[model samples]
Target chain A: MASTRAVLIWGALAVAVIVPVAIAAHSPLLAWRSPVYIAAGLAGVVAMTLVLFQPLLVGGYLPGLPRPRGRRLHRWVGAALVTAVALHVAGLWLTSPPDVIDALLFVSPTPFSAWGVIAMWTVFAAASLAALRRRLRLRPRVWRLGHTALVMVVVLGSVVHALLIEGTMGTVSKVVLCALILAVTVKVLLDLRTWALLARSWR
Target chain B: MTREHATRRAFLATGAAAVATLATAASGLLVPARAQGLAPTPSMRGGANNYLPGAPIVERIGGGGFWMTGSVRRAGDGAPLQGVRIQIWAHTTEGHERDPHSHGATLTDAQGRFRLEMPQIVPAFGQPHGHLAYDDAAFETVFLRPVMPSSRDTSLSADFVLQPA
Candidate 1:
C-alpha cells in the first residue's frame, strides 16, 4: 500500500510539473480556446515521463531501497500509467489532427513527432511483454535484456520529443527532465552492476 | 594448452560479449533522428498540396491601416497558394487592442498577396506590464493575438506563421 501510495504521488507530481509547462508553452492563457492543446501537451509529457521511469520504479533499482511491500502497488501504478498515456495521445490527436495522423503513419514532417509516436508504441510493447512474460517460458536473462532494451527505446524517444518542443516551458524544463533521466539511468546501471557482482561472488 | 590458458580465453570471450551487449544498449538510447536526420524540410509538392490562399486575412475595414504581408506554405512543402484568407488583429505592446476594433478579416489575391490596414496598435489583453520573452526573443515580445481564419478562404496566410500543428 505504501508502495502504491508512492507511485501515485510520483505520478501526480509528474503531471503537476508538466501541466504548467504545457500551459506556458501552448499559451492557453492567451486564448481560452487553446486550452485543449496545452492540456494535451502537458498530459503527453507527464505520461511519457512516467513510462520512462516505470521500469526502474517497478524493479526497485534505487541505490538503497527495500522491496515493495506488495506487487499490487506495482500493478496499480502500471495500470494508471497506461491510462495516462492513452489520454495523452487522445488529447494530442484532438489538438493537432493532421500532425497526429502523420505521426501515426510515420510520415510526420518533424522527426520529434515520429519519436513521440515511436515512444508510444514502445511503451505498448513493454506493457505487452509484462503481461506475457510469465506465460512465455522465456529465460530470465533473455527477458531482462529484452525489457531493458524496450525501456531504453521508450526513454530515448521521449527525451527527443521533449527536447525538440519550443514552448513556454522552454529550455529550463527540458534540461531538468534530461537531468532526471540521466540520474535514473545511472541508478539503473549501478543496480545492474551490483546484481552482477553478487551473482559472480555467489558463483 | 594448459587449463589456465583455457580459463583466460573463456574470460576474454565473456568480456567481449558483455561489451558488445553494452554497446548495443548504448546505441538504442539514441533517438531515431540520429539515423534519419532531425526534421524533414518540406518538399515543394508537400507544401503545395496543403497550401491555402486567402485563408489568413484577419479583417478588412474601410479605413486607414497597416498592411502586413506574408506567405503561408505547408510546413511539409513550399508552394505558393492562391485565394487564402487571413485575419490580422493585434494588441499593443501592453496587451491592449490596437484599433479598439472588435475583429478584422481579409482575403489573399491569386498571388497570395494580403494587406492589413490598421489605424493603430491596440492593447491586446490590457496593457503591457513588463517584458514578455518567447524562446529568448525580447523585442519579439509584442502581444499578437491570432485565431484561425474563417473556412471560406481556400488558402490561408497568417500575420505570424504558427508552429506546425
Candidate 2:
C-alpha cells in the first residue's frame, strides 16, 4: 500500500513536469529557432517545473510520505536545475547572441526579455545561497526566508516570460502551465506554513 | 579471503570499471575524424523554372549591395545551373528604399551571379523583406531587417546560399 501510494505521488509529480514539456515541445504554428534551441527551452521548462516543486519535495509534504531522502537529492536536484537554466541561456546565446545579450542586460527592446532575465538571476541567486548555506552558517529561518523570497521572484518572472512568448507553447498551453505553477506554489506554501505551525505547537 | 584483500580487490575492480567508462565517454565526446569517412553532404534539389545551372551564392558585401554569386546547375543530377533568374530585395534601414512597401527584387545573371544594392541607414523598427524567388515559391527569406549601419560608407556583408527546402 505504501509503495502504491508512493508510485502514484511520483506519477503525479512526473506529470506536472512532463505535461508542460510535451505541450511546449512543438506547435504547428510556431517555428522554433533550431532543434538545439527547442531542446534547451524544453529543458528550462522542466528545470523550472522542478524548482516550483522543490519545497514540497524537501519538506515531504506528500500525504503518507516516507522519510525524506536525507536532503542530498534535494541539493543535487537544485544544482541540476541551475545547470539547466544555464544551458537554456547558453543555447539562446548561441542561436542569437545579440538578442540574448539584450535580454540579459535588460536592454532588449522586447518587454518579455526583461522578465526572463529577472527570473534567471533570481534562480541563480537562490541556487547560490543553497550551495553556500552550510558554509555561511546562516540560520535556518533566514535561509528559508531568503530562498522563498527569491523563488517567488523566479516564479513571477517565469510566469510573465511564458505568458509573453508567442512561440511554441502558444496561448492555451501557456495559460495551462502558468496555472499549474500557481497551483503548485500555493500548495507548497500552505504546507510549509502548516508544518511550521505544527512544529511551534510541538515546542 | 582476508578482509583487507577482499576490500582491495573490490576497490581495484570498481576503479578499473570507472576508468574504462571514463575513457569510453571521453572518446565519444571527441571530434569525430573527418578523414575516416566521406564528409556528410547536404542534399539539394531543383524544381520547375526555379532550377538554374551552377550554385547561386548571395553575399552582403558590407557596403551598398549584397553580392549574389553561384554557378547555374541543371535540375537533374549535378550540372551547373546557368541563366536562371534570381530576385533579391531587402528594405533599407531608412524604410523601404526600392519598393514603397520596403521590399526589393532582382534577377540572377547567366553565370548565376547577381548583386542588389542597399543604401546604408538605421534599421527600421518593423520587419525587413529579403528573399530568393524561383517559380511561385520564395525560399531562404529573412523576415527580420538587417542591422542598418549609421553611415552610408559603413559596410555590412551577408551571404545567402539557397538549397532545396
Candidate 3:
C-alpha cells in the first residue's frame, strides 16, 4: 500500500514537470529558432523543474525515498541545477552575445531578462557559498539562514522570470508548477523554523 | 527483458504516430501565403495600387493627423510580437491612397503595440479604409485594410495576429 502511494505521488510529480515542457516543445516559434536558443530555452525549463524538486527532496516529502537518500539526491540535483543554469547562460551567449551581456548587466529591454539575471546570479551565489561553507567556517545556523535567504531569492526570481515571459508554456501549467515550488519551499522553511528566526530577528 | 522491449516499442510507435499527426495538421499553417493574391489589389489584398515598394521606416507618420494604432501578436499563443513592420497607406485629408505621400510604415514596440499619426482617412472606393501590411521574413506576410467607423473619427486602429511560416 505504501509503495502504491509512493508511486502515485511520484507520478503526479513527474506530470507536473513534464506537461508544460511537452506543450512548449510543440510551439511553432521553435521551428525557426537557432539550436543554441532552443538549448537555452530547454535549460531554463529544466532548471525550473529542478527548483520544484529541490525543496521537496530536502524536506523528505517524497514518500518512498529515505531521508539520507533524499539528501544525497538533493545535493546531486543542486549540482545539476547549477550546471543547467551555466549551460543556459552559455547557450544564450552563443546565440546573442550583446543581448546576453545586456541581460547580465541588467539593461535588457525585456523586463523578464532582469528578473532572470537576478535569479541566475542568486543561484550561483547560493551554490558558491554552500561549496565554501567548510572553508569559511561559518556557524551552522548562520550558514543555513543565509543559504535559505539566497534560495528564496532564487525561487521567487526564477518564478517571476518564467511567468513574465510570453513563451510556449501555458499560463495555467506554469502557474501550477510555480505554485508547487513555492509551497514546497515554504513547507521546508517552516519545518526548519526559518520564519521563527525572522520573527525573532524582527523583535 | 522481452516485456520491457515490447513496451518500449509500443511507446515509440505511439510517439511516432502522434508526431506524424501533428505534422500533418500543422503543415497547412507552415506554408505562408503571399499578398493573399496578386497585388495591386483592393480591400487589404495588399499591394497598394500606388505602392512605392520602399517606404522609409518611421515612428509616426504625417505630423499627427489621424491616429493609426495597432498591435502585432503571434496567432496561436497571442504573444506580443516585437519589431514587426506594419505598413500604412490610405486616402486621407492630406492625399489620395494612390499618392506616395499617404503611404508609410512603423514597427511594433516591445509590447507589440504601435501608433501612428496620419491625416484622417477619407472615402476611398466609397469607404474610408486604411491599408497596412506586415512583410517580414520572421512572420507570414499580412495586409490589413481596416475601415474607419466614420469619416469624422480622429483615429482608427487595426491589429494583426501573424502565424509562423
Candidate 2: tens digits of C-alpha lDDT, residues A76-100: 7778888888898887676546557
Quality of model 2 by C-alpha lDDT: 0.56
Per-residue error for B67 in candidate 1, Å, reads 7.5
- Supply the TM-score for candidate 1: 0.52
Model 2 lDDT at residue B44: 18
lDDT on C-alpha atoms for all candidate structures: 0.50, 0.56, 0.77
Candidate 1 residues lying further than 4 Å off, grouped into runs, are A1-35, A52-56, A59-65, A70-74, A168-170, A194-203, B1-68, B71-113, B116-165
Error (Å) of candidate 2 at residue B17 is: 99
Question: Per-residue lDDT of A59-122 in model 1, one digit per residue for the tens?
Answer: 5743333347323455565666677777867876665454467678877545567787888888
Query: Rank order by lDDT, top first?
Result: 3, 2, 1
Candidate 1: residue B26 lDDT (0-100): 83
Clashes in predicted model 3? 1
Per-residue C-alpha lDDT of model 2 across residues B1-33, encoded as one tens digit per residue: 446555777999999999999998888679554
Q: Please give the clash total of every predicted structure, in order.
A: 54, 30, 1
- The CAPRI quality class of candidate 3 comes to incorrect
lDDT of 3 by residue, A88-195 (tens): 889877754655676787755456778888999998888888889899997776777788999999999999998877655667888999999999999998887876
Per-residue error for A164 in candidate 1, Å, reads 0.7
Between candidates 2 and 3, which one is better according to lDDT? 3
Q: Per TM-score, what order, best first?
A: 3, 1, 2
